[model samples]
Target: MALIILMLALQFYGVPHSSMFTFIFSGVSFEEILSRQIHLPILWVSYLIIPNFIILDAQRILSKTHLIQLRGFQYSHLQFELISLMGTLFITIIYVLFSFTWIIALMKMTHAQIFSFAGLKEMSSYFLFFLMILIGLICLVLIQATLNLFNSVLGIILPFSWIIFTSFTVWKFNPLNGLMLLRYSSYNTIQTFIFCFIIIIVLTTTFLTVVRKKDFI
Candidate 1:
């Protein structure tokens, strides 16, 4: 209900739809959709609720299966590292693909049509888009840190530092360019952001649960 209200308000404010972010397939353009303006409910259905469902399920699996927990070390365990590494790798690979394709999309949107090789410098105008990747990374660290803080204040100090790092990145960077997306395609970076965000959350939770099984004593 709250999400629906927020979505309606955003539409009233002309937020411009941002549902184009999908990780299922690569190299596909969103040109086929017939709806000029889609219902806001579609945004929640395609963008928010479904993906979070996956995260919730992933957490359940990790907790029950003990995928990340293992017997080793005093400060850290093999399971924790493995789980965190999974989160890191998931974020890294998605970031790489998003960074590459998003830049390509941005270049195609902002600058005139040019071969991929031609618009390298002008494309760099949006360094902040890349900064968005940190949004996912920092969010993962923050969740773990906050959890650790509840258990052991000292454990979360590093993750707390990430709050500062994320702030710094977001402070100087604002690349939403909401209008450009509607003009070019039926989507925006928010799709990419939310998709990646859920993945990071799953991995982070998995890592924390696995690692904490050992160090949580």
Candidate 2:
């Protein structure tokens, strides 16, 4: 099984291309990975080592918490715990990796200028990303409050409401301007900001609502 998994991972990571080291990502098949001219070393590290590190770290955290195995909880299961733990790890890797990736990219691109903003116009890209994550948290809280009070289908209503509210806010304030905060967080052009948003939301929600409240007996 380990050998098979390794083979599969080899397929997924593709291979490193040049000394520049820019083109490598997850894939499920050789054909899918073929689109990027990734070379051999990057392929091995990204596909096998990285995922193993993520899963192992997740497992360690879960072992420490042991919340799901607590006898008194009304909603606790090993399967659910495993999934949640994996989600936690995956989201962590995504945000941190993207953040560092962009930071380095910015450093390299701008020659390590030590980013600082002096404009009275709009927030810097890093600051904007921070604001965006904070706003998402605040909106999530407002959604939960609204759902609790008004008894709406929060799973559906919350996202729609967030979109509408964010749209209104964007149209009204126009703080971000034309500068995309997302650009700093991705190496590949195909990597979208939506993933970062999802990762941030998941991480924030889980930390605020779940892990903090869970009893680890």
Candidate 3:
């Protein structure tokens, strides 16, 4: 409920479509401005809120004795972890779908210039980029969950550490030339898929190993 309201507020006032490129010397069309503004919040939501929710949900599952009892049919920590992963995945999918749908609906209602084919292609590219970032975030959240399971303090520290490191990297090295994939890349379809697969595999493997070795109460 709070998230929904916050998203609505951001849509109205966060970044105005008309003034997006005001400082740039090169003139940008209204369509480009509208598209950029529309997608900006989508990127923000995926990058900021989703990961926090992932960690929070994982923490709830681990900390709540009743939830543990209900979910732990076999009294297995692996089972609990798996359940948490599945739940987090489901929530992430729903959020992605809803955000995309809402953005499309808003564009249509507002008669946004991005309704054309070119705009749609651009939007599709952005969506793909968002999904790639989301996959990485999920992996990071899983790792955090594992840390939280091991020691509550690590859970709190790791997230802040990651945020600070990422912020510094983005500040020092622009996404266009940096290691961040949040910006669109020129990789072909096969290359992109392979890259995403490798990252997901590495992160997931590490997360699983950490969780598997942890001594859960």
Q: In candidate 1, where is summed lDDT lowest over 10 consecutive residues?
A: 20-29
lDDT of 3 by residue, 75-170 (tens): 455666677777766776676566556555544444443323322246665566446445545555655565666676676566556544443332
Model number with the top lDDT: 3
Ranking, TM-score, top scorer first: 3, 1, 2
Candidate 2 residue 129 Cα shift, in angstroms, is 6.2
Residues 1-217 of candidate 1: C-alpha lDDT, one tens digit per residue: 2344334334434223222222111111223223333222233122222222223233334444663343323324444555644564464446445544653454344442323221113345233334443454445443443344234343344343433332223222222221122222223455545655675677567656756665566
- Name the regions of candidate 1 deviating beyond 4 angstroms: 1-54, 57-60, 67-69, 72-82, 85-89, 92-96, 99-121, 133-216
Alpha carbon lDDT at 204, candidate 1: 64
TM-score of each: 0.33, 0.27, 0.59
Q: Give the TM-score of candidate 1.
A: 0.33
**lDDT of the structure predicted as candidate 3:** 0.47
Poorest 10 consecutive residues of model 2 by lDDT?
Answer: 18-27
> What does each candidate score in C-alpha RMSD?
13.4, 14.0, 7.9
lDDT of 2 by residue, 20-41 (tens): 1122222122232345532233
Best by TM-score: 3
Taking all chains together, the TM-score of candidate 3 against the true structure is: 0.59
Q: How many clashes show up per model?
A: 1, 4, 0
**How should the candidates be ordered by lDDT, best one leading?**
3, 1, 2
